[model samples]
Target: MIASTSASATIVEFTTSHGNFTVNLHDETTPITVSNFLKYINDGDYDNTVIHRVVPDFVMQAGGFEFTGNFPLTAIATDSTIQNEPVYSNVRGTIAMAKVSGNENSATSQWFVNVTDNSAGAPALDTTNGGFTVFGEIIAGMDNVDTITELSLCGTTPMPDYTAEQCSDSTFVPGTENFVTIETVTIIDSTVDTASSLNSVKNTLLSTATPVTPTPTPSSSSSGSIAWLGLFFTGLIALRRRFR
Candidate 1:
């Protein structure tokens, strides 16, 4: 499901159930993060994966779990965690890695797209957890990403194109068709090699004190799993702990 272009290659196209979008990787500025992403793509680790987390006006996340025709999504196999590369800002349309709360270098495979300007928004990602590593930006098909964000949530999972009526129907039986699936990811162009203008923004919110794990609410699902409890709550609490 992953292929390279003959030309200078740096852009990757994601074909999803809703549509397609292309991302220009920050190969020079965030080499470690970019290389980590490409390894998962080349290994076919992202194929058939579902965008398991969607918070309206926040972030739409994927690359952590895959659907195998069942409930409780399967966690994708991960390599060792990569070093933190917080060189860029988490602005709108940018893509960043999701990691355990307080651990700057804990990013493995899970990633999220900023639906809003997270750097200046409620979750000032630039100041959180050594700053979420922004490694790429959506170059084209941002409308598709916007459409995906508008999809309604069924519990914590976003149901692609499923209407509110359909989601509210008690008789509705959710299936793989209901989930937003990443069909294929191909390297469209590789010529691009520059970082965004938003690069070099240092993270000043990283704390040297030991990280204190928050008490898990009774409703809290285990960290790294897709069963989120609420919207911003999970985005803040779970993602901070083990959402990756």
Candidate 2:
């Protein structure tokens, strides 16, 4: 794995059955948002969380909220909602929270994945309404997302039609199962893995990135000719002195 640059707060490598995606968390811009996500990661709450909803060209929603009709009520929706930090536009490969239409302060653990580049949802909330919070960006492994997009779906599988002035139920789960249920989500903190500096980097991880080979240089055999020349010069000087 390559070293993270200064812009990245922490490189979060998610090992999923589909594939691994390494996302860079903008902790500085969205501290609470990042912390909320990290809470689920730290508590092992997202291990078996299923990607319950997948709207092609929209977003993939997940986070142990409603798995196969089971909802965790104790799971705090959001004790205190943080101001929306959408400075970075909600483009493709961005990870943002999912919220209801009228309620801006109700983003819970559930989030969505942006399939297409949504220009309207960038950096700021829609003036007509409070938009989703754009916290982290997907740096690598978007193929996993593509695979989720192409999964088989069943039941209210598509977007629900909400009438005007209708209160949207954020927790509403259509009978359909859109994408493959995520077996497990493991959030690895790679920094701590390097704390001891004793654990050697695995060859598999290194081989995935780039292979570094050692270069071979010529030995000092060429210098022996110079030594011989110096000895000959000394012998010539001795002979010259004797002849003189």
Candidate 3:
């Protein structure tokens, strides 16, 4: 079921196939990006969407396509692309916008969550593609995000409900249950200001010195057991799409 959005919402909850999670928007710092995201939520543009791409240990992307009992997923209708607002660093649990390879302002409705710290490495998200716009961070249910990453992949797409047998079968046709669907995204709080309390160095990439990587702390939820697979950096680069 599609969720409704509140005009003054800052903390939003996402109920997905794996589980539920909440995010605190950096509305004060990235107002434009926040407003753009809220517009999609308000219009129900993200309803029943699939988390189409998952690069293990890197990111899980969604909000671009939907499956309506079809083989090939349909692209969600997008609004006009918003301007680049690369204010925050792309760290673990942070959500950012995805855009075309060479374009910085082409982001419309597609967004990805950084499963690991991709802020300062070779494919540093902070310095790549004019830096992916980090607009929100997970405040709860990150374990659900980690759990979604462990699902077997059918090509570049992640199949949340497919069994090991079905994933390997060539003739297997995925129905609505095969994808990690965002069942609903509703505003839960408007009073909390989690983004305001974030450390300056960790929140902003405008600093010259390398951002400090926070100690790996497991949040309260089901902990993922799969070891990090070989990092697929190219998968991050291929996310570039020329939205028309």
lDDT of each: 0.69, 0.45, 0.70
Put down candidate 1 lDDT per residue, 118-149, tens digits, no spaces.
Answer: 77433657755666788888888989988887
lDDT for each residue of candidate 2 in 1-244, tens digit (9 for 90 to 100): 1222222234566665566776666565566677666665665666655554444555666663424443221132333444554434556777776554445555556666666664342212222124456667676788888776665432212222322222133344333232244454445543422223322111122112222221222112221211211101122111111100
Q: Which residue pairs clash in candidate 1?
A: 8-190, 8-191, 9-190, 10-189, 10-190, 101-240
Off by over 4 Å in 1: 1-9, 161-173, 192-244
How well is each residue in 1-244 modelled by candidate 3, as lDDT tens digits?
A: 1122557567899999889989889877888888888889888888789887776777888888888775556778988888888888888999988876556677888888889988765446776556678988998999999988887776556775566666555466668887889988888877536677766335354445444332223221212211111112133222222211
Candidates, ranked, lDDT? 3, 1, 2
**How close is each model in CA RMSD to the real structure?**
6.7, 29.6, 8.9
TM-score against truth, every candidate: 0.76, 0.56, 0.78
Off by over 4 Å in 2: 1-9, 64-81, 121-128, 156-179, 189-244
Put the candidates in TM-score order, highest first: 3, 1, 2
| Total colliding residue pairs, candidate 2 | 5
lDDT of 2 at 46: 62
lDDT winner, 1 or 3:
3
